[model samples]
Target: MNTLAFDTCFGACSVAVTWATPEGPRGAFRFERLERGHAERLMPLIADAMSEAPFDFSALQRLVVTTGPGTFTGQRVGIAAARALSLATGAPVASLPSLAVMAHTAAHQLKGETAGKTLAAAVDARRGEIYVQFFSGPDLAALDEPLLTTPEDAARRLAGRDVVAVGSGSQLLADGARAKGLSISVRLATLEPDVRFVPEAAIPTDFGVPRPLYLRPPDAKPQDGASLARVS
Candidate 1:
């Protein structure tokens, strides 16, 4: 079986193609950090990754994508790409949350370094907010629910705790966490949604409705005088 996994929920866009082998599985990955223009770059990156792997889409048994509470545009692009690829190839599709992916990366990295320490995965939500989640040890037990809140607020909420803060939000919230006396080991650039930590599952044959994990509503709303149409 062959599988393709991708994540664009963060600053970097990544894709991997894996093929089951008698020895286990072999895969190839491509990643690029795009400050902007994720939509323009993702497809070409996917094409390059696929080309390097030399695998045909029709031969793929599964397609996996990271659904997110990251950038709204990035999340939409990733999920839409996965769904479209699955439909075109008749492959099963599976979705994993962006926070979970970050946690996975952290857990994998902290295997022997922090014997009993807890880890926190966070992403910049912009507008003075962060998308955050907590985990314990390598197993990555969930310590709290995923949320979007101000850096100061999150620091206060998780104060007086020793945590290995991982992800971009760590940098964004570093000052607040320090001021709050939180025992935080800032490891911002270390954690990323890479292939090694991605969880695997049997892709569902049914492609149900794909949903975005938006912590809050969009910033823009239609004007009162703007035309609105209901397809249904």
Candidate 2:
């Protein structure tokens, strides 16, 4: 199957066009790291990724996207693009969690003895907190609900565990754990979710239609006084 997958749920905007063949899975992708401008870059990145292997949008059978515990603007930009592309191409959009994507990426990158270790994925949520989750293994079967928490608090909860932490919050979480005399390892300085794995992540699960997965309420609130009157 030819699939178009993309993620704009964090500091990076990434897109990939992948095919599942008898030989194995193969694909190409574009990844750009930036704190802003995801809206401008995501679509073009997707097009570029597809064109790399001469895959057309019409050839896409599925659209996989990261539904996020990420930046508000980034999350909205990704889901909207996925939904619109699905409608235009008649491809089913599969929504996967960004945190899980990170976990899997970390797991795949782990070497030797670390390969089977427990994983902790965390994204910097800003304001001194992170979007954190624990997984039994790389498949990211959740050991707990994704939580918005301080690094210290997260470390406390996951203390005494041998965990390979990934994502932007990895360093902070690792440091916190070490300070608390717990065992934790940092896999990378940052491991933003990869769109290349979005398809794999979706295929094995009941991936529903793409939707924004903001773990907490948005910082922006509605203006009740400016609201239109209710029709009913």
Candidate 3:
């Protein structure tokens, strides 16, 4: 099966095309770091990937995307594009969470060093908040639910545990965690929680319901009459 996968849930945007073969999975093309203009760049990148690989759209077996707890706009753009492409080409679509991608990358790169310990994947959320998730072993079992919280709060929650922290939130969480007497070791990894490191195994067989994993309520919403009257 030939599959196209992408992620735009972090600071960088990435896309990859892979073909399944008897030898193993082979990547035809992989691109990353397009960043905030993912909506604009996504289609072109997909076209470029397909062009380089010379695969027929109708022959594509799956379209995979990173559904997120990252940037709201990026997640929408990526999933929308994936859905559209899937519909147009009549290919099945699958979605995986962004933190799962980070976990996969960390586990793959740090295979021998960690000796099968738990890893905390953290991504920077604006306003001093972070998106955090925990994984155990190479299979990436979830130890804690993903949350959006301040560094101190997160540190407190993860206190008294020996964990390897990876992501943008690692530095802040590590410092706070240590100050709070947590025995966690922070591992600074190059893999951002972005779509760039999405693994082939991360893709699901079924594209479940599309829902944004917002840890906190959105800032923008209809104002109450009291505030409106005060302003008026």
Candidate 4:
């Protein structure tokens, strides 16, 4: 089976195409970090990665996308692109949580015994809060519900626990944890979700319409004063 995965839910834009070969399953992936402009760059980047794999969209069996707990605009960009491609190609779509993708990446990177360590994935929410989640070891099982809170509150919740923080918000979370006298076994602050690892979070049987996983409501709201009354 051939699968394509892409993520634009945070600071990075990534794409990957995985296909089965006689030898084994193999993939081609492209990832780049940017402060903005995912809308402009994502398509070209995906094209590049697909070209490397030489995989055609018509042959895609599955399409996986990160339905974010990240930036609102970035999340929309990814889902819109995926949905459009799905409509054109007739491939089934799968949703992968962005935080879970990060956790999976962290767990996959761990070496040797990782029995008691928690994998904490976080993304900066841009108003001094973070989008966060926790998972247990390489299995990446959920340890808590997805959360949006101040870095300090998040740290307090994880106090006395051993963790490995990974994501854009890792440094801040690690700092908060240290203030609470918590132990962080490792910190991977520079890491961004790679689409190549997204398959780990894909739910084939639970497939449904993909949507942005915004834990908090949008910051911008329509101004009531400027709104005209609806014509009845």
Best by lDDT: 4
lDDT of 1 by residue, 1-232 (tens): 6888888887878888888768877877888877678788888887877886647888888777888877889889988998888789988777777787787766667666545776778887778888988777556667877889988888887776677778888876676787776657887554667654665542334545467888889888999889689799
- Kindly give the number of clashing pairs for every candidate: 0, 0, 0, 0
For residue 15, give model 2's deviation from the true position in Å.
Answer: 0.9
**Lowest lDDT 10-residue stretch of candidate 4:** 198-207
Q: lDDT per residue, candidate 4, 121-162, as tens digits?
A: 987776888889988844678888789988889998887677
Say what the RMSD of model 4 is: 2.3
Please, what are the lDDT tens digits per residue for candidate 3 over residues 1-232? 7888888788767778878678887775555664579798878888877886647788888888887887878888988888788778888778777888888777767776555676888887878888888877656777777888887788887755667888888887787787777767777645665344555555677765456666667778767664554564
Question: Which regions in candidate 3 have their CA more than 4 angstroms from the true location?
Answer: 194-199, 222-232
- The model with the greatest TM-score is 4
lDDT comparing candidate 4 with the true structure: 0.81
Ordered from best to worst lDDT, the candidate numbers read 4, 2, 1, 3
Task: Give residue 215's error in model 1 in angstroms.
Answer: 1.2
Error of 3 at 116 (Å): 1.9
Better of 2 and 4 by TM-score: 4
Name the lDDT value of residue 197 in candidate 2. 53
Please give the distance, in angstroms, between residue 220's alpha carbon in candidate 3 and its true position after superposition: 2.7
Candidate 2, residues 132-172, lDDT tens digits: the string is 98988535577887789999999998865778888889888
